[model samples]
Target: MTSIEIRHNLFDNPEVSGTEYKTVELIIKKLQIYHPDILTSDIKDGHGVIAIFKGKKQGKNIAFRTDIDALPSGHRCGHDGHTAILLQFAEYIVSGNRPETGSIILIFQPEEETGNGAKKILQSKVLQNLHVDYIFGLHNLPGYHLGNILFKYGTFAAASTGFIAKLEGKQAHAAYPENGINPAKAVADFILALDSFKNDDISNFKQITVIHVNIGEIAFGTAAGDANVMLTLRSFTNKGMSELINNVTSELQQLANKYSLKVSYDFQDKFNALENDDVCVDIVKAAAKELNMTTESLPEPMRWSEDFADYCLKWHGGFFGIGSGENCKPLHNPEYNFPDELIDIGAKMFLKIAEQAMVD
Candidate 1:
């Protein structure tokens, strides 16, 4: 099947993180046709697929990966296209321009949106048995010239985690509100205190975005005894993110104590900052140059999070971006659709990177 066909198939039947069964099944079916030397769909949770092609002569082993799960809703994020690109590159390896030395591993990784897939893959028996020398991956970036290559030497993305604070107190009739402790004031104070943690310094960037807040029910006769505040915290480096978490948690406990409210904290979807290997990054730039592709260097790391950070931390690799278009819709927008033209550019880019890595 063609790459565009594979992309459309994934788009028509999208799956979210932690529930990528159909996506895995379809990828396995297409990859079987390419006849990789070794193919696996049963590693760990069996929600992702791995295909391996070996060269006749022994050399370095390189791997390329793509996030396969779509967002929880709206079918945004361009993951379907990412999967198609890797699948197309796999097909090319079998049909033409086979690597003269070393091996190629195409990893269709699931649960990237939930920040669990890469860790799971790292622990999988399949990956543990194979030693990979160099690795690479990419994301589609909107608001740039279509097919342009965008990269950064150090970090490509930021570290981020979700925060949930639940407050509990005594409830009472609204008329006699003094009869019980109310948490409304505490919740308000907590949110305002969170603002003190926000900063945009390029050297030490940090951010706290409130995603949700809840304060009891709408019944006017009753005083709210419980409330919740949900936020996403980000930083340019892993150490900075840890500091942000520590400071916020300490202040949050103080607020709970001051208001005599029982508070609990829950953190979710933690992603480390993606720090690119300098050598791997240079290989990507060289590959793009070899292909005569337009390239742009990012002035700073992106404020977004990526689980691919997990792989880069475990091994040497770099993550780059493929421009979708200046007018393309922003990711996570309900109207967003991955530009189909990116399939060829991204797949060919991976091919060139594989060629460059075999000799590096």
Candidate 2:
């Protein structure tokens, strides 16, 4: 099938993270045509697909990874096109494109939106057993000319996590005169404390966004006994992320103590910063150059978290972006569309990168 056909098939049957059952089936059917040396879909995560293409000679094991799940609303992030691009690359390899030394591992990773797929795969020891030397993945970026290659030396994307603070205290009647403890002060202070981190003189970039807060019911008949504060914490580097978490935790703990409130903390959807290896970046750049594609080096790391960072932490990995188009809608937007034109461009880029990685 053509890349567009595969993309549309995926787009039509969009599946959310942790539930790419049908999506995985379609990917398997398309990849079966290529007959990878090893095609296994039922792995640790149950949704990740691993395909290994053996080389005529043993040398370097290069893995090309792609996310296969879409957002809950739909394929707002264009993962359908990502799957199609890697599938097309799989087809090219079977069409007499063999590696010079080591095998090529193609990963159709699931739950990328939830930041769990890569970690689960790693725990499965799939890539660990393969001893992959270099890994690569690409994401589509809007607001640039179509087919433009975007690259950065390090921290292509930031690390981010969702934090929830649940505060519990005694409730009393509204008419009570300081008869019971209230968590309102703690919640307010927590927000202000986190906000202060924005001015930290730390070397790493950091940010905190207060997404939500809940104190009491609308009845207004009773004093508030509980509160919840939801925030998104972000940092440009993994070290920075660690520091951010530490700072937030310490401050929140202090507030809970001062207010005599029983506070519980939970961090969700944690994504480590995407660190691009210089060597892998140059190889990708050379591959782009060979394809004669226009390339741009980003001035700063994107302020978004990417799960691909999990793979890079274990192996020499590089992550880059392909321009969807100058007028393409931002990702995750309800009305955003994955440009069909990107299918061919992404497929070509993936194929070139794979073919070149095989020999180099």
lDDT (Cα, tens digit) per residue for candidate 1, span 1-360: 688988999998998887889888889899888888889986687498888888898888899999999886736999999999998888778878777787898888988888999988778777887889988999999988999999899889999999998999998999999998899998888889887887889889999999999998899999998998999999999989999998888888898899999989999999999999999999999999999999999889989999999988878988999998999998888888999999999989999999988878
Question: Which residue segments of model 1 deviate by more than 4 Å?
Answer: 72-74
Q: lDDT per model, in order?
A: 0.90, 0.86
Which pairs clash (backbone N, Cα, C closer than 3 Å) in model 2? 58-101, 59-101, 59-102
Looking at model 1, report the run of 10 residues with the lowest lDDT sum. 41-50
lDDT by residue for model 2 (30-94), tens: 88888888888866755888898887787888888899999978999999999988888887777
| Residue 306 CA displacement from its true place in model 1, Å | 1.4
Which predicted model would earn the best TM-score?
2
Worst 10-residue lDDT window, candidate 2: 195-204
Clashes of 2: 3
Query: What is the Cα root-mean-square deviation between model 1 and the actual structure?
Result: 1.9
Q: Score every model by TM-score.
A: 0.93, 0.95
